[model samples]
Target: MFGESSGRWLDSELWHACAGSMVQMPPLNSKVLYFPQGHAEHAHGGKVDFTTRIPSFIPCWLSGLKYMADSDTDEVFVKLSLTPLTQENTNALLMDLEDGGDDCGNNNGGVVEGGNQEKPASFAKTLTQSDANNGGGFSVPRYCAETIFPRLDYSADPPVQNIVAKDVHGNCWKFRHIYRGTPRRHLLTTGWSNFVSQKKLVAGDSIVFLRAKDGDLCVGIRRAKKVAVGGGEVSVSSVVEAVSCGVNGRPFEVVYYPRGSSPEFCVKASVVRDAMKVRWCSGMRFKMPFETEDSSRISWFMGTISSVQLLDPIHWPNSPWRLLQVVWDEPELLQHVKCKT
Candidate 1:
């Protein structure tokens, strides 16, 4: 039903927001490589001394993966335990694990399962340059307006209405949706620019609009990696703190930011083993399965492997970190891919 399952069009929002949405534990008893150098990158200026004390990577066995989130921002991170496997030497694995994990880590009773879960009508729109410009207006698609939005009274002179939507952080935003213009289309005119300015939204960032079961409008944001502004949302102190906690044999957490720029200092053992079995080389095309929402719908991002090279051949010889240079179908969404000039 994938063909008909999505009411969403080819806009990049649905793909960015819901695709690969599930964040799971890195299963206990699995073998993994912990990269202290990569972890220090996130700690950029924090001068995390763990990088020097630790080798480029440490062979370890996954003891735990407890999912959690920041109380302030509702961002998902994982509390994990990795014990050093002194028997296995470093740089033994030749392929890196996929940097994949996604979840809001709500303290509320985990995720709601079963197909009977309420799924209201939803529409996602990626703001165009015009929509995010200084002009205070966000153009609304006709289908979205007629279906997900509240009905309008055409009899009114200008046919205008005030709409309120809630963000992931539970903040309320009001927009003046109006029907006016030569061809007569729906647009969020009054509060659109204000929302964009406050959220720092740009052309590529997506705004998802939906009708809740309670009949209220809900809005969510999906930011592309480029908008991360100065690396990413992970702070220098936070990265150093997480790695420090890990070294001290206490549970530490890492963020699940699945972008090329954000390297995975923590990864699933099974995913790494499977990837290591592949003899990846130049000119290999593959479809990566990325699930979202209920975890039932599956979407794939097509890509071609361009070359296989060591990220740090000098310091970490034969290390698999970012070893494969590839071109993804949606190159604009990733930062570290090999792009043609």
Candidate 2:
């Protein structure tokens, strides 16, 4: 009688085990595409119409993951995804989408060859004493100045320009940029102190700047990582790293992935708080993108929360970054595994 059995139950068990294995596998650092409005066919079509398009998908790097506690269960049920590139940094990206056009006017009143485009530069620099003190200037690296800033008019004295910088909140800050001193360097004077004060930036935090396609400057902040000394609980800090200018020039925090092998993505404090406010329960369906071997491709997986794990006594009881075990469907993966979402 055992031999005559169809063995359907055994097959089901094996299938679930395989799905669980896939979910338990650690994710790697790779590029993935994010479609804000689910998936659309026109996204893959050539000559995408930006006008009628609600919002196009963006490609970004996946940095890491952090677990958060479920408010209902008071256990970790959600994982916070992290990435360095956020929508705030999309100005440069959007410009690239515009067929290599340089709207930033040059001295010749003409677009420079290759659209005067330079690869976006990113680096970490500690705030100096002058930057931390009341001094109204922030020193910029010479390489950053030359690459990220508009081409300077050396003929003009001081080589100064009034720049309108957009913050993570899409707030426009008018600042003065001048190339001055004996050897000649780049500095953000006048409004520098105000920005520092408003953002509560200190001597240790790092600043990130990017030049958009329209020659407008954008800025982001990166706080130094904190150690959990003797604690295993994962805590989400309210740190703002990068800012992206959304539709109608609304500035919002750009998710920042720090420079390291971490799986944590730096998101706005408000985002974390908002997510935690939602009640997540076991058996609830969860969907998120997963990277394929190509890195350029992205696939979505749907899973149900199997169990919520509470933090150890040594861990922070209130921390949101906790652990959740999930079980995914198999046949769905076979059908949609290669499709972009």
Candidate 3:
């Protein structure tokens, strides 16, 4: 006997159970990379310097929280502290330029603005022994060789091109680029050794190159962090202190500065999905990480999200990643804005 009342009650009960189990998950705070396309490595063997293996235009994305566990009644989260990797944040982490403090041995011209104009156009490379030695040549990444450097005449036996670049000090140097090797790698020859000698650069230092709005190439340097001191073993505390410090209720330091600037700093797709689960709204209080120039330490900047704006509709329409306009309590730092998950 088919009972209409029983069937109706059973269907209703099943619908309610399904609805209860569909409770939305909270947004996850995870790290991600924004890797651009077409920047793949060709050579692989020996001790590969992963730093050099990074693609051009890379920037690190550091979040202030990490996921722990979830419970039915309450969810658990862990606070994560990270340092800024971009040059502007690195300058803030290493020096105290804000209050007319001393410049912390930065050879690169005063910190340049890192807005949209600079982030996409700039690239960095860590110097290698071969780059600083009397070998008279330096290896150039494939992406830089193809997109950033001048065009090469492949018809020639070796396919060569000459590039004139200006350092932060406004000094110009000419470098010759040649495509050679079994897989045809790009190398900077001729004047590379001269530039290295003039700059007094050594292995472990980094060279940053930026294409100015005027179409001229500009270069800068970032010295590597010193590990050993006075024949004494490097302590973990000293290493942590070298990168960040707390002062006036703020923490500043460099967390992860990659050897190259690549588009890979964008958050991963899975991380984005987790982040989207959270219902974010304006006026939310958050602690953003930044580096202080005086100590090169990582610090936190407390601010409230003022508004959310979509990416340029011309290029990205209805994009899930939105720009966040953050207004810090300090008026001087009011202009800082970041991308939201």
Best by TM-score: 1
Clashes of each: 0, 15, 36
Tell me the tens digit of each residue's lDDT in model 2 across 176-229: 889999788899898988888876677765565666545556665444332122
Cα misplacement distance, residue 23 of candidate 3 (Å): 40
Task: Kindly report which residue stretches of model 3 are placed more than 4 angstroms away from their true locations once superposed.
Answer: 1-120, 226-341
| Better candidate by lDDT, 1 or 2 | 1
Per-candidate TM vs. native? 0.58, 0.37, 0.36
Candidate 2: Cα lDDT at 228: 26
Off by over 4 Å in 1: 1-38, 45-124, 133-135, 146-148, 151-160, 200-205, 210-216, 222-241, 256-260, 286-306, 327-341
Give lDDT for model 1: 0.57
Report the C-alpha lDDT of model 1 over 1-341, residue by residue, as the tens digit: 01212122222222223222433334455666677667656554524553535455555666654433223322223445666554323233332333222221122333322123645676667678998896668999887888878998889989999999866545689999999999998999888889988877777556677677677677765554433332224566766665565565554445433332445666655455556668889999966555432233556668999899987676667677778887898966432221100
CA shift of 101, model 1, Å: 21
Model 3 lDDT at residue 319: 42
Pairs with steric clashes in candidate 1? none
